[model samples]
Target: MSQTNDYPLSAVPQSARKGFWSTAFVLLGFTFFTSTMWAGGTLGTSFSFGELLWIILIGNLLLGSYAAGLAYVAYKTGLNSVLLGRYCFGEQGSKLADFVLGFTQIGWYAWGTATIAIILVKLLELPEAYTTPLMIVFGFGFCITAFIGYQALALLSKISVPAMLAFIGISIYQGSIDIGGLAQLSNISPTDSMPFAAAITMVFGTFVSGGTQATNWSRFAKSGRIAVVTTLLAFFIGNGLMVFVGAFGAMIYQQADIVDVLVAQGFILIAVLMLFANIWTTQDNTIYNFAAAGCNLLRTDKRRTITVVGAAIGTVLAVFGMYNMLIPFLILLGTFIPPIGAIIMADFWFKHRSNPPSLDKIKLPAFDACGLSAYAVGSAAAYFSPWIAPLVGIVVSASVYALLLYIRSAQPVAKPSAS
Candidate 1:
């Protein structure tokens, strides 16, 4: 199939829609991310096991709901985030959304690329000299499925999700035994304390960028309801598993990452397999996200070409140490990315009435002041807010966009200056 068959520049046709399991597995694989485990590890250190569960449940619920809202819009219109941006952000202004969203995905791609390479060397006791070569190999290799597009992603996810779950279940079972079971695990105390708000922000921030771009696949859902359910399945349940695994490891073994915990538990072989499956699933999705955004940014249908280019860019970043910058990158994502989804949702519900016009059927403005303005305000609010920044960004931006729409509608026409 052609790159255009991926529909980089247009809405997907009804004939192209996928079934529930296909959509669900694709999204679930994307959510089975290692960085989320790291985020959970951070939370594990700061909260009791009971408090961690509460935080994970609440945070993933918020994340799932936010993704599901966008998924419904995507399913209705068959347009991803960048295409939706054109309606609210206008033709030219949408490029801002493209760059911001695209950059974050690449950052994540780079970090994941760097992480697996580093972890492999450490775990296998390979020479330090192997790190760069492994990074080079894995960085491009992981995008192979993504370069093949949605069908390949679904197949890989269908296999990897179950396998990863099994690996996690074994690790958790072993961890429980080593730590003297769940009762003792729960009674274990936190080594540190953090505000609940900050914890929520970390949990939400960890995947908000991916959730925003998930529309790239959600747009292919058979129906809006399917999109919503699939999105929630991935972001809520799948992502929640990542958080739980990380926190569980930290609480029992004083290791926040599942791979490290696995090695600590003498599961070296399983650790290698888990790392490959975990990183590959997310890496393909991440690079695919960059390609989608890149396509819209460049106004081209060359998604395959863009995929290669993105992998190269990410590989370079990974080689130069993208892994070390993860926390700050995630914070930046949480602060700025949610507003893009917020504006798109507001435009869909308020301006489009949940039924946006076809991209081919209309000529969009060069810029929509309402979207650009609201995004700025929302990002600024999120940056400064003492509350959970991502949630704050979404609420503030959507409210501003709705208010702007209302104000615009209520205004009287000037009647061509009484000509």
Candidate 2:
């Protein structure tokens, strides 16, 4: 029996690549998240059903394209985002990405841990005293699959993805029957107003952090085409389905989470099952993301150890009530996180021309002035932008990086002194 560290510090070897379905299921499970549904619920209250569809499609398309571009780079280089940061952000500079990305994933993990425990206690009529214990239990429990590494994640997704889809399908069918189908749904007007730009930003912000880190599994893809296509399917179609379900539930019952909607529909048993499956799938992926980033941060191959340690940190946060911090946390993620990915993309395409050298084969600088400067500029622009901040971040970061590159290239070279 061998342990799979999942090649945390290096490229995934060619022999270790995965086929399309294997890759797709892992990514699908990652994107099929409960929080995404919650984001959709917000949209559902602000727009008509038709408008919600357009918002969801357009947002997920942007998310999918971004993930696919990174996936292609991951496939070609056999490196995950944190590993790619070494090339893009430089040796010591990459740790900036490592901490930010890892911290965000831990936030998600803590939120999910606290969410499931709190929801279960309420739904099951358990004593409030059970909440903290449940958080402790689930926070550690969810990371078990991640600790086992990629095979366990894929195995769980293979089972959970289909099961979740079936459950969502059943819920949707029941909702339609209860509401008298599409015409009735169309007549249900929004109770609130939100600007179209804000709606788009919300939708895009919902999963941009996860999408940015999807290279964790995308690097295992058999080819660049496989990586790109699978990433699009997962982030676009799979994530779109989650959002639609959330919005549909919101429109019909004014409940955002599918689990809550199921409960409202008197599918108590089904609600419990969906809750576990939904949260578990995404939780494991989230912590797996944390583990991957942690590994790169510490420059270690001990992924399992980091998985346990990350779960512990997430549990502590959950105990202290990380669930209540979701909105502000998401806003922070939306403003600051997209710029990291944009800088990575700019580094890959413009700097490396999409062919970065092997990590171990080359000596890297402590920091890349261009990447760090571009990220700072991008983050600032996003933070201040009145429009869609994530999009603004992406555009500004890449543009600034390119401009900086041009300035550097234009500078005159000094002649060497005679030896």
Give the top-scoring candidate (lDDT): 1
Angstrom error of the Cα, residue 126, model 2: value is 0.7
Candidate 2 lDDT, 336-368, residue by residue in tens:
989888888888899888888898888999998
Off by over 4 Å in 1: 1-4, 417-419
lDDT of 1 by residue, 168-268 (tens): 99998898898787888678889989899888888898899999999999999999889999999999999988988988888887887898998999998
Q: What are the Cα lDDT values of the candidates? A: 0.92, 0.90
Worst 10 residues of 1 by lDDT: 1-10
Off by over 4 Å in 2: 1-3
Q: How accurate is candidate 2 locally (lDDT)?
A: 0.90
TM-score of each: 0.98, 0.97
Worst 10 residues of 2 by lDDT: 1-10
